[model samples]
Target: MGRIVLNGVRKAFGEVEVIPPLDLTIEDGEFVVFVGPSGCGKSTLLRLIAGLEDVTGGEISIDGRDATELPPAKRGLAMVFQSYALYPHMSVRKNIAFPMRMAGLPEGEQKRRIEAAAKALNLTDYLDRRPGQLSGGQRQRVAIGRAIVREPSAFLFDEPLSNLDAALRVGMRMEIGELHKSLATTMVYVTHDQVEAMTMADKIVVLRAGRIEQVGTPLELYRTPHNLFVAGFIGSPTMNLIGGAEAERHGARTIGVRPEHIASGSPDGAPWVGTVGLSEHLGSDTFLYVHGTGLAETVTVRADGEVPLRHGDRVGLTPNPDRIHRFDAEGSRL
Candidate 1:
């Protein structure tokens, strides 16, 4: 019953429109992620849904009820922010009980919910400790425990992991994914990190300059991007794009091939010839940056970690014709 729908939703500040009219739907128990570069309006969209910000036009509905004009507290949703906004003087138990206390729930109900949330987040032993006594990860769990106690219809996460270190971010990411499964609640998360989006989302909405560039599963966007912006942005190390004479040979204004799709040795007739400029061995895979290729200035290739290739070595590259992507002059897929 956590379904949320936005119909032609728009947001603006004075005269500058940050989010153009757009429509999106989040199904019950689905984990949806909004991702893009900074100032892409992902957070703004999340705020609009949370009722933290107002929309300039259109409607927002939660479970078939109009909530566009509802205040944040009345929207039946809980938000976890980038910062762990806990009261330093309060114990973890008190922090979690704050929400229930504000709503004037009975003491017995508050105690029950707090205990349940503490155990679920593995904070039972630490419940008596204050915020100053916990690590970064523990404090974050306390914040989430607070949200869990509220038991809102849906959860809104605004870059919740951004404040943690790399290792902690990874751990929290997995924890949040597990939380969603156990709770079976709809969750809307926002992040600029594509890796996080790829690992956590059931559906990903990619945006740029207030407009959605693509909306699909991680693999869908990776395998078949709608346009050049998507193709160049979705993958790690990025897909190699070549223009000029080489692209014309493929009957396209531009051509794209992912690093993993390019074989080190050319096939029957070599389409690309270069010298290895740099090689990176990451134990599991080797990435080679090839120079002097007639196509692009530099072509990146992913090869076996055991590949015996070194800098300045002459090399040949051949892309799998079936996997090659062609783009028109306007950067649209051909």
Candidate 2:
């Protein structure tokens, strides 16, 4: 329940700059996700906010207080790391209560907070279990619960779901979303998974090479990416990026279109054509990979249901002009 602000934040490891000067405002009780590819500085930014890494320049503030030089504990934030970071020797209850113990809370208040956190995370039955006895997902929950018991001003998650199985990841994602809703606390989650960002975040900060690429809601980034990098990175199956010359001939510098915007056959008001190179039936829809149009690689088109397309099928392809995105030679959106 605190507003977190970063003003001209920067990070560097000796001569190599990791994060360039960046400014972001995270409103109180908002869930903001920082997402990017590996080595793109998302985790670095999270660590900076958590005070795990000191900022090379600029300031970090939480709840109207400047905290640039504060230690991790003094920053009034709890971080749940990717590794869970649970103490293997401690029972679940003890582990979750450790932060309170460190802060010297009275026994009664500590017990009450621990019990409430365990119950909220559905860990009541596993309070006596050690980290060795819990499943990966359970251990992750304990890590989160430990953070919850601290009742910090904000929560920082660094790929907390990366170790879970696919199904567990989905379920835990929902749980985290619910946790945010119920707690109404400021949260900043960093992950390479775009799906996590798209599903959980009220706003997303997309980063690349230590610099921010775009900051917007999931749908806004999906619908209108500001550059080729974001246009290719934000979507499932990714958007198709045709060469500049080819796109310019079609009245655009570089054509970018989503799979769903492309069709298998000649749809009304559609333009561009390519031979269907490969088709994948995904039950609810079909993904057509079209090639041989002077494009760098195959273009994917999402069609409703199966469209009876196959590999090497000579088919005409068309994209909705209104749905097309144009980028300049430098990859900036035109």
Candidate 3:
């Protein structure tokens, strides 16, 4: 019963409107991620839902009840921030018990929930230790354990993994996803990293400049973006966009081809010719930046990890015609 709906929700600061009116719905037990570049207003929207910030217009409903004006705690939601927010002086057990203690729950209830959350988060053996004694990942788990004990209807995460190193970020991402499965609670997450959004969300809301560009499953946005901004932002290595005469030839204002769709070896007659500018080998795959391509200033091609192509090597690239994405002059999908 954790469904949340926003009807014409908006946010403004003085005379400037940061979030224009928008509508969105998150179903019970669904994991949704709000993602976009910096200053895109994803965090602002999350705060609006959390009741930490009041909406300038319209309403927020939780489980069909209006909660727009409710204070953060009264809204029955929990939020995990980018910072761990754990009390350094408190032991893991006490840190997790803080929220229950504040609410004046009985000592027995607090102990029960804390133990359950600790075991669930793999912190059972570390309960006696303080936050300063744990690694970054363990400390984050303690923070999550604190949230889990509250048992809120929905959980809101504000870039929870941003503080971790790359390897730890990956681990925590999977851990959070697993937590969602085990808890089966509605979760709304915010991040600027598309990779995190793709890996963790059941539904993804892509925002830019306070507006939602698109909302759908990760594959939906990746396979069929609504417009140019979405097409360019949703993929890794990004989709290559070409304009000028080359695009005109395709009866479009611009043409887009993903790096993976551009093959290095040309067969018959390929449209792009360039010298490999830089090559990155990551064991699993190779990324080749091709320069001097008349179609675009630089055309990136994803090649096999064992690709023999090197810097300054002349190459021809062929884009899979069926996979090409066409956009109008205003960057709308054609």
- Which stretches in model 3 have alpha-carbon errors above 4 Å? 266-268
Candidate order (lDDT): 3, 1, 2
Clashing pairs in 1: none
Q: Against the true structure, what is each candidate's TM-score?
A: 0.96, 0.95, 0.98
Per-residue accuracy of model 1 over 1-334 as CA lDDT, tens digit each: 7999999999999999999999999999999999999999999999999999999999999988999999999989999999999999999999999999999999999999999888888899999999999999999999999999999999999999998999999999999999999899999999999999989999999999999899999999889988888888888888999999878989999889999999997423677889999899998899999999878888999999998889988888988899888899899899
**lDDT at 172 for candidate 1?**
93
TM-score head-to-head 2 vs 3, winner: 3
- How far out, in Å, is residue 102 in model 3? 0.8
lDDT of 2 by residue, 148-247 (tens): 9999999999999999999999999999999999899999999899989999999999999989899999999998899999999998888988875678
Candidate 3 to truth, TM: 0.98
lDDT pick, better of 2 and 3 = 3
Residue pairs in clash, model 3: none
A best-first ranking of the candidates according to their TM-score comes to 3, 1, 2
